[model samples]
Target chain A: MKAIGSFKGEPITDSDSLVDVEVPTPDLAEHDVLVEVKAVSVNPVDTKLRAGAPSQKEPLILGFDAVGIVVKTGSNTTKFSKGDRVWYSGTTKRPGSNEAYQAVDERLVAKAPRSLTDEAAAAMPLTSITAYELLFEKMGANFGQLANPGKTLLIVNGAGGVGSVLSQLAKWAGFTVIATASPANFDWLRANGVDQPIDYHDDLETQVQGLGHHFVDAAVILYDVPSYYDAVTKLVAPGGHIGAIVGTQAKLNMEQLKSKSLSLDWEYMFAKGDFDFRMETQGEALRQIAQLVDNNFVHTTLSRTIDSGLNAKNLREAHQVVEEGHVVGKVVVSGPFNGQVNE
Target chain B: MKAIGSFKGEPITDSDSLVDVEVPTPDLAEHDVLVEVKAVSVNPVDTKLRAGAPSQKEPLILGFDAVGIVVKTGSNTTKFSKGDRVWYSGTTKRPGSNEAYQAVDERLVAKAPRSLTDEAAAAMPLTSITAYELLFEKMGANFGQLANPGKTLLIVNGAGGVGSVLSQLAKWAGFTVIATASPANFDWLRANGVDQPIDYHDDLETQVQGLGHHFVDAAVILYDVPSYYDAVTKLVAPGGHIGAIVGTQAKLNMEQLKSKSLSLDWEYMFAKGDFDFRMETQGEALRQIAQLVDNNFVHTTLSRTIDSGLNAKNLREAHQVVEEGHVVGKVVVSGPFNGQVNE
Candidate 1:
């Protein structure tokens, strides 16, 4: 199979940053589906891994969000069959989807929405899964029918990929949404279900307080974890939940959260993929997300499309786009080869 | 009314550290009870308050755990009548339980155990309330029957006032209790119900792993917040709950808790007392705890007592005993005054 990967860390602009190579396509297990990837999206993790010089014997393929078509199915596969279109956020520890053909656990892959194009579908999986898990799973958002609609959500760094999708989902789930972004993306974020878009450039706590809400009932932190610990601690209402996906080595003063009886939860989407539990739940969430998208209740965050062929040069271009740091929504790279193509 | 109180921050040995002061006895308000305090137990909070030289125009009486006889009840009082034996963990922010005659909110007081002495009853509240809230409320330990018993709890600083009771409660609730204490108190901690007591003097993580339980489903840190961050983080089972009662000013690395989806909860028993919500529940838990003691289901940690004559000199002696750091359970001082006193 033809794949794009990196062995050494370097700037994406460097010629050797990413290389086109041939590697053995993963063998399908009982629950595995062989997917021929058609479109893939670039995220911050891709650039972070590329710049870090990760130690690896084989080249590390660097794509997680992918839209593909199943070409073959293992004997025990029950969810997908040959010719089925699928979308998923691939496991973090294993090989990724910057390749022509990839084998994925059938439990983590869901049928692609018929209403959207492959590029649009590819951008939704990684961010949607992250946002979904952070809000509903990690934060334990009550989905009971009687849940109050007056609850509030504060989404920090709200114009990013995950935040953009999360804002809409939080609103759909009956929360009044408060999004934080720069003045530039205020209108865009407000149009996407945010009740208010407070400027992130200002003191976040002051800005949030200025909006007349004393505190948020829940919050999702999308940027640096350490920078907003105090702000989140102060802004969260008593007994509220705060979820973050970002990692930090800095010390966290757990005591700051004690007075308000606040709870801090970390949502790493990779846990399920790496630990191999509740994989089907991710797939189910994806299918439900697709239905919401098809019903025009939620929209994709694919803000830019770059036709970097599924090769070293194009992969590096995608990497550079993510590293630029101000991606409005998602940057998806369309296919160099259709799902039907074989080596 | 005579009370022992501190006007300045000084060692307990200082002659003037605690002075006898005459203050006006409080008039009973609606839902108020006038109790004649007979016995009171010393807790760490008393020492912490003493060390800080808490501001007070008049001398400030510092003790939260007390047992007494109800001398008078307001017209609206329904829970107890005059002459009822009672015990309580007083409000941290309010005037505490160190005076000859004290007026207490009717809601915070509970019926003292019929089978136990005043000192025994007083010894249970502050620690009992802290432990009950930390386990059942903060850590979400199910107090109902058919609770999940497969879980394990690692109680750091298990020989302190709160730890001494929480270890037994965790065991009674069917959890595997792993407590940390020094060699001197190992036998006492085990006898109280701790299945395992790792010597906190050694490296905590290595000691915990050496006990064959590599991780815990929940952890309650009663003291020494800053020093145990690493060991607590490493020993937390995936999707575990970590609750701490003490506050730490040091910044912590929040991202270390992300991989396993661990939750951090701070339990300040004082919050509810300060905010005035469901105050009756404290009394109810205390009443139930009294029943547990009457049936010999629980034992008091009070080990020593002194008749302090309700004066500053005797109060200092009580404080000295608590400050020595080797006291296993609790210290109590009874008065030569007409007040309800129970331990």
Candidate 2:
């Protein structure tokens, strides 16, 4: 099987940063399915892991979101069968989808949306799972046939990947969505169901308040956590939830949240995979997301496509596009395994 | 009406740290009940609010937990009638519960336990509300007749006011309770239904691990938050809840929580009262706590009582006992308002 990997932590511009190599096709565990990855999407985690030296003896395969077909299944696998189309953001601890074939726990893999292309399906899994988990699970937002829609949600970076999906979900749940972006992406934010789009370059707190929201029911910080932690605490109502997808080693003045008795929710989409805890829920969440997509309630967030297919060059270009930090939605690379392979 | 108050942020040793002052009896708002406070309990919030200089022109009266008799009820108040025995931890925004007569919202007052003394009833509210909110509400702990008993809860500072009540509630919910206290209070922890007691002086992580728990399902820090935040983070399982009631001005390494997708829940019992958001819930929680007490599922945490009554001297004694720390359970000052009165 051909896989593009970073042998060492290096800039994307370095030719050796991502190189094609041959590796044995992954063996299936009892609950595993061997998937032939058909398409892949580049995310911030992909860039982050790419910039770090791999802990494994093998080179780091940098990918998360993928639409693939089940090639084989382990003896105990029950959720998926061979030839079934699937989409998943596989475990961060294991080899990723930037490969011709990969073994993934069947519980974490869900059927790909029939209405979307492989590239589009690949773009939705990681960000969709992240947004869903943070909004419903971590933040404990309530939604039913008749949930109160008077509640408001603030997304710090609404034009980004997770933000784009989360805003749509929040809108579907009938929440008032206030999101942040530069003036240039205001239209994009509005199109994605953002009720109010505040300029990122301007004062976020002032702008949010200027829009007449004294405090949001919850605020999900999809970007720099430390920079937004204080403001989010202030913007959230007493006893509200504040969700963060970003990590920072720098200390935070968490006491600001104390007076309001707020909750800080950290959403690392791969936590279930890393701990081997509740992996089936990811598949279930993706199934729900797929249903929403097929129903036209939610649309795929794929904004850029590298039809040149999944080679080292296309993978590198996808990483570079995400690294530039202003990509509107998601950048996906379709697959034909044009990357190098050992004879 | 006579009250014991702190006009300045002064040491307990200072003669004027707590002084007898005459203040006007408060009038009732639409939802208010005028209560003649019979007994009061000292809590950390009482001490904390006492330490701070009041923003209002009046001296700060620092009582929170009180058992009283409704002397009058406002036109809109329906929950209480004159002569009704009630228990409450009223809002910090108001004058608090340190006077001969205090006007409080009916929604923040619940019927006092018939089986307990005024002092005993008074000792339960502030801590019980804190514990209930932290355990059930903030942590989102599931509790029912047949809730999964497999979950484990860690209570840091297990012999303190909130810890004493919280441990019992956790036990009732069938949780395996792990609590921290001085070696001297091991018996108290056991008596309070803690399955495992770890010494606070020892290495908490090593001790917790030695007891065969890689992680606890939830941990509530009843004491210093900054000092325990790191260890609590390490001790909580992936996607578990870490609850805190103490506020700290110092910054915390909140990033460590990102990997496990953990949640930090801050439970300030006064949040509802302070914000006027859902004051009715506090009364309902107290009613539940009362039922638990009557059913013998819980007990008053009061250990010592200042039968000398709620005067400047006795109030100072209770404050001193609390400020000294390490006392098991809670301390209370029975009240008949024997302080100086304006003629």
lDDT per residue, candidate 2, A179-249, as tens digits? Answer: 99988999988888899999988888899999998888999998888888888888898888999988887
The digit string of per-residue lDDT tens for model 1 on B37-109 reads 8888887778878878955678878778889889988878999898988999868776788887788888888
Q: Which candidate is the best by TM-score?
A: 2
Q: What interface root-mean-square deviation (Å) does model 1 yield? A: 2.5
The global C-alpha lDDT for each of the candidates, from Candidate 1 onward, is: 0.81, 0.87
User: Per-residue lDDT of B49-129 in model 2, one digit per residue for the tens?
Assistant: 677775445778878899989988998988988899999999988888888888899999899988899988888998999
Question: Which window of 10 residues has the lowest lDDT sum in candidate 1 chain A?
Answer: A334-343
Question: Which of the numbered candidates is closest to the native, going by highest lDDT?
Answer: 2
Candidate 2: stretches off by over 4 Å:
A54-58, A143-148, A339-343, B51-58, B143-148, B339-343
**Candidate 1, DockQ to 2 decimals?**
0.44
